[model samples]
Target: MDYQTLIVAVDGKVATVTLNRPDVRNAFNETTIAEITQVFRELGQNADVRTIVLAANGPAFCAGADLNWMKKMAGYTHEENRADAAQLAEMLHTIYTCPKPVVAKVQGDCYAGGMGLVAACDIAVAVEATNFCLSEVKLGLIPATISPYVILATGENAARRYFLTAERFSAQEAHRTGFVHQVVAADALDATVADIVKALVANSPNAVKEAKRLVQDVAGQPLTAELIADTAERIADIRSSEEGKEGVRSFLEKRKPNWLN
Candidate 1:
């Protein structure tokens, strides 16, 4: 699909979605958010796309909301503001629950709503020099929409401090706080993301999809006997299925799996 604020490229099994507004550090406006929501839906339906990598074409991955856009919205009525915020919230949810695995390739500073984008990804890799901040408080605004995803990525304790302070943190700190998955040299960002994509692509698509579902299915749920029995039954069914049988046979024969071969 053609886009004005973003670019989409498909190569083999990987789809790369690039934020294209480099002049403003790829800051998101309403159009950009709308495009992202539509693009993710498109890629989710594409059979050839097994994984998606979100990156940007500038010094920073994203600087979050467009200040000018926010300024304009300051005069909007309560109802109008609700509608506008809902658009962004829905877009973030689209990426968060995307069927295909979403990976973030962050190169530089990510602030405010940009951090929500990172949190929405299933996995994220950041350059060593990359910095992160949840700076809405600095502008006398709150990160209302991104709160759920950010809290999921970073626990309440970390969020409490960072959200209030809006202080910039290092890539390592971001990883420690559970925002970033890995940190590598800026020059090696591509290689690192490629390696991760390779690893993800080597898994059974069905299994990966099921596992992603499992994470959400079991989250915050009690481990009851019925739940355990249900899980066991599900695994037993998969073990007797074609993909599972092939996986076992390939392992026993000391050969590469179907996904790799």
Candidate 2:
């Protein structure tokens, strides 16, 4: 689909969604947010797309909400503000729960909602020089909508400090806080993401999808009887499926997996 603020490209089994608004550092407005939501929803339903990459053009990955958009919203009524905020919230949620693995390629400054986008991705690779901040509170506003995704990415303790302080953190610190999966030099950013994409593409799409769901199902759960029983049932079902049989057969035959081959 054609978009003014973003670009969507599909190559083989990987689909890339790039934030194309660089003049304002890719800061999101209502139109951009809605475009992203619609594109992600489409990608999620496309069977040919096995994985997705979220990247942006320009020196800054994103600067959060557009200043002009914020200015326009300043005079909006409470009801109007709520509706607008809900749109942004739904966009974030759609990306977070997308079935296919989503990867973020962050090469520059990522602040506010930009940081939230990285947090929502399944994997994120950032440049070593990249800077991150949760600067919502500085403007007398809060990162309320992105809080759930950010808190899940970074723990409660880290979120409490950064959300309140609005301080800039380095790429290493972001990795430590669980936001970035890897950090590479600026020159190596593209290759790093490519390597990760290769690894992802090498895995079975169905297995990866199932694994993602399994992680979600077990997260925050104890090793209770019910949990164990649930997991056992899931495993049993998979083991009885065609994919599982092929996986075992390929392993014993010392040949490349069908998906990778």
Candidate 3:
């Protein structure tokens, strides 16, 4: 599908979705949000695409909502605003729950709603100098739509401080808060992200996808009998599957697995 705000390119087993509105620092308007939701959903089901990289083409990774879009929203009634917010929520959900692994390549400033995109990715890597902020409170607005994923990325304590303060934090701070998985120097950012993508692609495609879903499914759940049984059932299902048998057989036979071959 064609996109006006994104550049989608597939290279072998990996697909890169770069936010392309550099003129606006890749900010999200309704068009951009809709396109993001549609493209991610498409890539999730594309058998040829095993992993996805979410990147941007500007000085800022994303600057949240576009100014013109904000101007339009300023005139929206309460119900209209809820409808608009729901779109943004769904866009974030698409990325968070995508069947394929998503690695966010955050190369610059990630502010407000942009941080939501970062939080939704399965793995996030940022440059050492990259900045992040949840600056909605400053505008008398709240980061409500992105809160679920953001809260999951950064725990409640970190969220409480950042949400209320709306302060700008460094890449290191983001890593410390567990929002970003890795932070590297600007020069090393691409290499670091590439290595992660390589590792992701090397794993069993089904296992990788299932592992991601497992974490999303089991996280924050109390360790009850039902939870334990569910986990056991999941393991049993995968262990008896075609990929599982091949994985074990390949290791014992000292040969590359069919996936690797």
Candidate 4:
């Protein structure tokens, strides 16, 4: 599908979905949110796309909701506002639950709902100059929709501080908080992201996708006998699967797996 707010490109096994509204600091509106959801949904189903990189083409990665969009919302009724927020929530969920791994390539400022985008990714690499903020409170709004992913990425303690303060934090702080996996110089951003994509694509696509699902499925769940049994069953299932058997056989033979070829 065509998109006005995003630039989607694929190279080999990696697909890059870039927020293209640099003029508005890539801040999202309803249209932008809907487009992002649709694009990711498509890419997630494409067998050729092993991974997705969330990126932006602006000095600011994203500044959250657009001013005009917010202005339009100010006049919305309570039910209308709920419907609008639901779309944003679904969009974030789509990225968070995508079967393929997602890596955020953050080069500059990321804020509010933008923070949601970064938090939803499976991995993130940010430039040293990048700044992140959950500034919704400052605007008399809450980071409600993005909270599920943001809280998971940033942790409850850090979320309490940042969510309440609405203060800007550095990329280093983001890395420290575990939201960003890697922090690199601006010039090295592309290389760093490429390196991660390389590692992801080299792995069995099915296993990588299953691994991602495993994490999401098990995280925050209490350890129980049923859970333990479920995990055992899952491992057994994968071990007997075609890809799993081939992976082990190739490793034993000291040859590249079919996926690598």
Q: Residues 133-198, candidate 2, lDDT per residue (tens digit)?
A: 999889998999999889888889999999999999999998998888898999999998988888
Tell me the lDDT of model 2 at 67: 92
lDDT of 1 at 148: 92
Best of the candidates, lDDT: 3
RMSD values, in order shown? 1.6, 1.3, 0.7, 0.8
**lDDT by residue for model 3 (50-107), tens:** 8999999988999999999999999999999999999999999999999999999999
Better of 2 and 4 by lDDT: 4
Give per-residue lDDT, candidate 1, residue 183. 94
Candidate 4 lDDT by residue in tens digits, 1-261: 679999999998889999999999999999899999999999999999999999999799999999999999999999999999999999999999899999999988999999999999999999999889999989888999999999999999999999999999999999999999999999999999999999999999999989999999899999999999999999999999999999999999999999887
The residue-by-residue lDDT of candidate 1 on 20-127, one tens digit each, is 999999999999999999999989888788899999998999999998998889999999999999999999999988888999999989999999999999999999
Q: Which stretches of candidate 4 lie over 4 Å from their true place?
A: none
Of 1 and 4, the candidate ahead on TM-score is 4
Off by over 4 Å in 3: none
Per-residue error (Å), model 2, residue 43: 1.3
* Candidate 4 C-alpha error for residue 77, in Å: 0.8
lDDT of 2: 0.91
Global Cα lDDT for candidate 4: 0.94
By TM-score, the candidates rank as 3, 4, 2, 1
The CA lDDT of each predicted structure is: 0.91, 0.91, 0.96, 0.94
- Per-residue lDDT, model 2, residue 94, is 90
